[model samples]
Every structure is written in structure tokens, then in C-alpha cells.
Target: MRVQALIFDVFGTCVDWRRSVAREVAKVLPQVDALAFATAWRAEYDPAMARIRGGERGYVALDDLHRENLQRVAAEFSVSAPERLAHAWERLDPWPDVVAGLTALKARHVIAPCSNGSIALMTRLAKHAALPWDCILGAEIAQDYKPKPQVYLASCAALRLATDQVMMVAAHNDDLFAARYAGLKTAFVARPTEHGPHQTTDLGPESDWDVIASDFHDLATQLTP
Candidate 1:
């Protein structure tokens, strides 16, 4: 089926989460260990998401998750953060190719983010990074996260397209697999640095995704008009 729309996974897919968080934290506490702080903060993401998924905790927005993790990491590292520092997650910097690549793709098809981020969080990040999404879709609406078929299908339903008519683009293989299971086309855009120096998985595509690219721009190039 011809792809009518492109849905993106944010965080490490379009934005450099580690680098962006480090940069922002560095601004607030120049002497703080920025890289370590970023990693420590991100370390809590999966466990927190799991808590919600397992019914151990109720649904919490990504922003809240980040803030909660940030506080815990800050105490662990003895880093004193300013009031504005907690908003670092909302101010992530987009990958260099994001704007240009999305601009090129958006010219031909509807583009949006189908992410684990909450609507408010995604909207703020889009405004901060100038992401050219025609719309923003998040798991908050479904009370779930990526790797869940409902999240992918919800995005397609919102766009009024069949599952096969929309494509899911992400840096993670699990995300692509979930989208494929949900009947959407899948694209893998590798983000080798997503998990920083300790990164082990997702260094490259783990599955035979419909399309694989070095980045969004390359994905845009390979996509059919």
C-alpha cells in the first residue's frame, strides 16, 4: 500500500535526548556532571513506564516521569538544580536533520509524532524545536506506551487512515515490530547514540523493516511519493 502519512517516534528518534538533556543541564549547573546526570535521569524511564504498564502505578505524563526521575538522580549525584532545570525535558534539541527532513516529507504527506510522550509534552517540544508535525499523537490518550498495538492503531485512527496507509518511523526495533503487528508500514532510523556510551541494543536494525535509513532525511529520500 502507498504510504499516505508518516508517524514519528520522538525522544531519541528525532531528538538527541541524551545530548539535549546534558546540554540543558549543563546550562543550569555548569560544574555538574552533565553526561552522568542525563544518563541517570534516562535510566528511570523504562522502569517507570513499566510500573504504569504493570498496574503498579497510575498513568503519569512523560513530563512528570522525567521530573520524578530527575529529582531522584539529582539526589543521588548531589547536584543542585535550579527551578528552570526541571523543564529540560520539554526543551530537548532536535537532531540536525529533523526540521529539513520533516519539511521535505511533509510537503508530500501528512506527518505527526506517534510517541510515548504526552500531548502537552510533545506540543511543547514541537514548539521548542520547531518540529513540522501536522499533528501530535501520544500514548497518553490511550493510557499506554510504545510497543503496544493500541498506541499505533490510535494514531492511524486519528488520521482517518487505514493501518497500512500510514508508516511508523522510529529508532527502536521493538517500536517497528509493534507497528508492523498493528498493520502499519515500518521504517527504522538508527540512532546509535540514543542510549549514550553504554548503549547496547538498537545500534542497527534488528528486523527486516520495510525501510531502514541513517536518519529521517534518508528515510524521506527512500519513501515513495
Candidate 2:
């Protein structure tokens, strides 16, 4: 089936969150290990969302989760000014190939983010990173997070497309696994440095996804005209 839309996983795949967040952290907590701080903060993301997914907590925007997680991680490191640091997620930088690739891909298909990030967060980050997104979709719209059937189905419904007509692109194997289960075609764009130098997960495509590309630029070559 032809892929009419490509819904991206933004945080790590479209943007270099680790390095960018670490850099931002360095500015605020000059004494802390910026890279480790960034890693620690991200480590809490899934667990935070899991609470909501499991019905232990209610749905909240990524910003709220990030802010709450920042406070906890900051206390762990005894870092001051956690409030300022929480905004780092908004200022993340895009991967080098992202702009060109998204532009190329957008010419051929509708391109949007199906990330866990909120619409406001995604909008600000997109502006900060100069990302070209057609629309923002995902947790905010679904009132639920990814790896859940509702999130993927909500995105497909919003775009007025069938599940098979859309492709979910991500660097995370787990995310793609769920998307595939939701009946969306999957694309794995390897983001080896997403978690920094020693990252082990998502080093390559973990399963036989519908498409696997080295990066968004390569994805453009394979999926875009």
C-alpha cells in the first residue's frame, strides 16, 4: 500500500535530544555531568508515561512529565534552578539531515510528528529546530501515549487515512513494534547517537520493519520522490 503520510518520532529520531539537552543542562548546571544528567532525565520518561498508560495516573502533556521528571533528577544531582532546566526540551536541536530530509519527504508525502511530545512542545521545538512538520499528532491528540493502540489509531483517524496508508517512523524498536501492531507500516531510521556514544539500543533495525534507512536523508531517498 502507498504511504500517504509519514508520522515521525521526534525526540530522539528527528532531534538530537541527548546532546542538545546535555548542552542545555551544561548552561544551567555547570558543575553537574551534563551528559549523565541528560541521560538520567530521559531514563524517567517511559516510566512516567507508563504510570498513565497503566491507569495509575491520568494523561498529561510531555511538558508536565518532563518538568516533574526534571525536579526529581535535579534533586538526585542536587542541581539548582531545575525550573529553568526543564525548558531544555523545548530548545532541542534537530539532527543535521532533518531539515533537508523532511523538506524532501514532505514534497512527496504528508509529514508530521506522532511523538509523545505535546502540540505546544512540538510546535516550539519545531520552530527552534527549524523543522518542517505538516501537523502535530500523538499523545496530545490521543490523550494517551505510544505503544498503545489508541495513539496510532488516533493519528490515522485525524489524517483521514487508513492504518495501512500511513507509516510510523522511529528510531525506537519498541515504538515501531507497537505501530506495526496497530497496522501502520513501520520505518526504522537508525539514530545511533540518540542516547549518546555508548548507546546500545536502536543501533540498527531490530526487526524486519517495512523500511530501514540510515537517516532521514536516506529515508527520503527510499520513500520520497
Candidate 3:
């Protein structure tokens, strides 16, 4: 069946999370290595989610998890994490191509973020970055994290779409791998510097994803052409 919806991975795919977080850190903690602190804080993200995904913990919003992770990273740096710092995730700037590219795609396909971010987080991030989303869906809807079939399946169900009629667009190959395995079509957009200039992973498509595009603009053309 033809794909009717295009759901995206928001963080590194649509916004520059590393640089954005680093910028926020610099503003709050001028004494520390902001980039390193941002990197370390982000490093705590997956492990925290893994505990939930592994059934070691119950479902929790990512906003709470970010708060917990912030405390941990702050302790490592011997500084108290300011309450406002946790909100940094909500204020990330989008890539230059994102607004226009998504606007183009939104004209033809249902566009929303199927991100790991909680609804509140994604909602604020969307407003802050001016992302044009038809609706919000993802882990919060499924009460689980991605690479899990439930997240992908739940998003499709929420849209009243069959799995095959939805396409998962992400810069991370592993996310696309899981979405495809869960029966969604997949698109890979490279965010080579998501981790930083020295980033070595996901610099290119690792699998033969249904679509591979250089950016969201290229993706819009490829899908709508």
C-alpha cells in the first residue's frame, strides 16, 4: 500500500540536540565544559530508558527521566543542576531545512513526531522549533520506548493507519531497523553530526531502508515526487 503518513524521530533527526543542549549548558554553567556536560547528560538517556524497557521499572515520562539524568550528570561535575536546566530539551533549535521541508511533506502526507519524547516535551519542542505536526504520537502513547514493537505499532494504531501505510523517518538506522521490523516502511535521513564532528555511527544508511535522503528536503522530494 502507498504510504500515507510520515512519522519522524525528533531529537537528532529534526533538531540538533547535541549543539542545542550544549548551548543551554553553556548558558547555565559557564564554569564547566558545556559540550562535554551535554554529551554526558545525553549519555544517561538510553540507560535510563533501558531500565524501563527491560521491565525493571514502570513507565515514566521522558521529562522525569531527563530530570533524574540531569541530577546524576550534575553530581559528576560537582554542581547542582538548576531546575530550569532540565527544560533545555524543550527548547532545541531545528535544522535549517526542517521547517520548510516538513511543510512540504505535510502537504501530501500526515506528518507528526513519533519521538521517544513525552507528549508534553514534544509539544513544547514543536512550539519552540515551529515544527508543523498534525499530531503527537510515540513512546508516551505506548508507555514504552522505541526499538520496541509496541511504540511503532501504537503510533500506527493512533493514526488509524495500517503499519504498512506509515513510514518512519529517522537519522538513526537502529530506529528505522526497529520500525521496519514492526512492519512500518522506513526512511533514513543522515544527521552525520548529531553526536558531534567525530561521530562515527549512523553517518550513512546501514540497511536498505525504503528511502534514503540527504535531508528532510530531499526526503520530501523523494516521497512526494
Candidate 4:
């Protein structure tokens, strides 16, 4: 397969959102269950995006959605300072192999993030995590979220490349499923620890992805120039 670019699914794929957000939660809500709070807050993400994707609401930046969700969960957890806590997402740390792996992958293919995050959120996260990306792509570009064909196609359009020439690299089977439907090449990088030690799903590849890698470094090695 001829591939010229590799677009990543940031959140859990590159940065360990679960742990990073949990760490932040512990700082602000010491008496709360940090991991559980993080999980509850994130659980609100998809349903919130579905509102926009289904046309119930217009496009809202991921950061704003995050803040909204933070407030909702903060109330449930009886936590204060929801605004400051929401900003924690901007400072997520990348998985150990991400920076080095993407650096190597960038040697051959243009690298970017095709995430649901807004450009500002993606940029801050990239800088905080030290990810080497050529550009940011995803929902903000399409004004829609993943699983929506427009999101994937829009990113490909932004790069002026055919969908088939750009591979969607992600850890979730559902994400790969959507990208494959959009006519993009697909690669799955197993991130068993993405959701934490108890992650029951996405522990391994669920389909015949073009490449099934154990980590980003392995993916960089598998991609042909």
C-alpha cells in the first residue's frame, strides 16, 4: 500500500489521558476517587459529541466540551474549581514510546493528529507532550467528530491527498472501522494500558488492519516509505 501520511488518534493512543487526568484530579479533589472521576468525566465526551454529530447542536470546540463535561462531573463528585481542573487535559503527558516513535515515523511520512480535539487543545497537548507533528487534523477541521466520514475526509482534503494515501493510525477498533469506511488505510497500535491496567477492550487488534503494532515504535518500523 502506498502511504504518504500518518494521522494519529491522540487522546489514548499517544497521550495517556486516563493517568494524566487522574493525576490532575488527585491534586484538586484529593478526597475524590481520581481515576473514577477521570473516567466519569471522559464518559460524557462521546455522548456530548454525538449531539453535534447528529445535528442537535452546532460545532463546539473540544476544549469547551471538556469544560462542560468537567462541570457536569464536578457537580456529581462535589468538586470545586471545575474551570482549572478542565485545563488539566491540555497538559497530558505522552506515552513513553510516542515522541521517539513519531519522530522516527516523521522521517518518512508526514505526521499529524486526527483527533476530536480543537486546534488549541491539540496544540497545547502536543507541546506539553513533546509530540512531533507536521500539523493538526480532525473534528475541528470537519466541524464533526470521528465515525463521521467528513472528519476523516476533511483531514485528507486539507493535506491535498487521496484518502487511500493517508493511513489512520489508532488504538481503537471502532476508529479504524470508521477510517476504513472512509477509504483510508488503517493501522492499529495496541495500547492496552491506555485505559489503565484494567482495560478489558482494545487490548489487541480486532481486525486485519494494514499494520498491527504493539506500540508506536513498532508502527514506525512497519510503515514503508
Looking at candidate 4, the ten consecutive residues that score lowest on lDDT are: 77-86
lDDT of 3 by residue, 172-191 (tens): 99999999999999999999
* Local distance difference test, candidate 4: 0.92
Report the lDDT tens digits of candidate 1 across residue range 1-225.
Answer: 689999999989999889989998888878788988888888888988988877788888877887777778888888766656768878888888999999999988999999889998889999999998899885887788777788898899888899999999999898898899999999999888788777899999998999999887898899845
Selected candidate, larger lDDT, 2 vs 3: 3
lDDT winner between 1 and 2, please give it.
Answer: 2
Query: What does candidate 4's lDDT look like per residue over 1-225, in tens digits?
Result: 579999989989998899999999999789999999999999999999999999999999989999999989988988675587888989899989999999999998999999999999999898998998999999899999988999999999999999999999999999999999999999998888877788899888888998999888889888744
Candidate 4 clashing pairs, residues 3+ apart or interchain:
none
User: Each candidate's TM vs. the true structure?
Assistant: 0.93, 0.97, 0.99, 0.97
For each candidate, the alpha-carbon lDDT, in order, equals 0.87, 0.92, 0.95, 0.92
Candidate 4 Cα errors over 4 Å, as ranges:
none
Query: What TM-score, to 2 decimals, does candidate 3 have?
Result: 0.99
3 against 4, candidate with superior lDDT: 3
Candidate 2 or 1, higher TM-score: 2
Ten contiguous residues minimizing lDDT sum, candidate 3 = 216-225
How far in Å is the alpha carbon of 38 misplaced in model 2?
Answer: 0.5
Winner of 1 and 3 under TM-score: 3
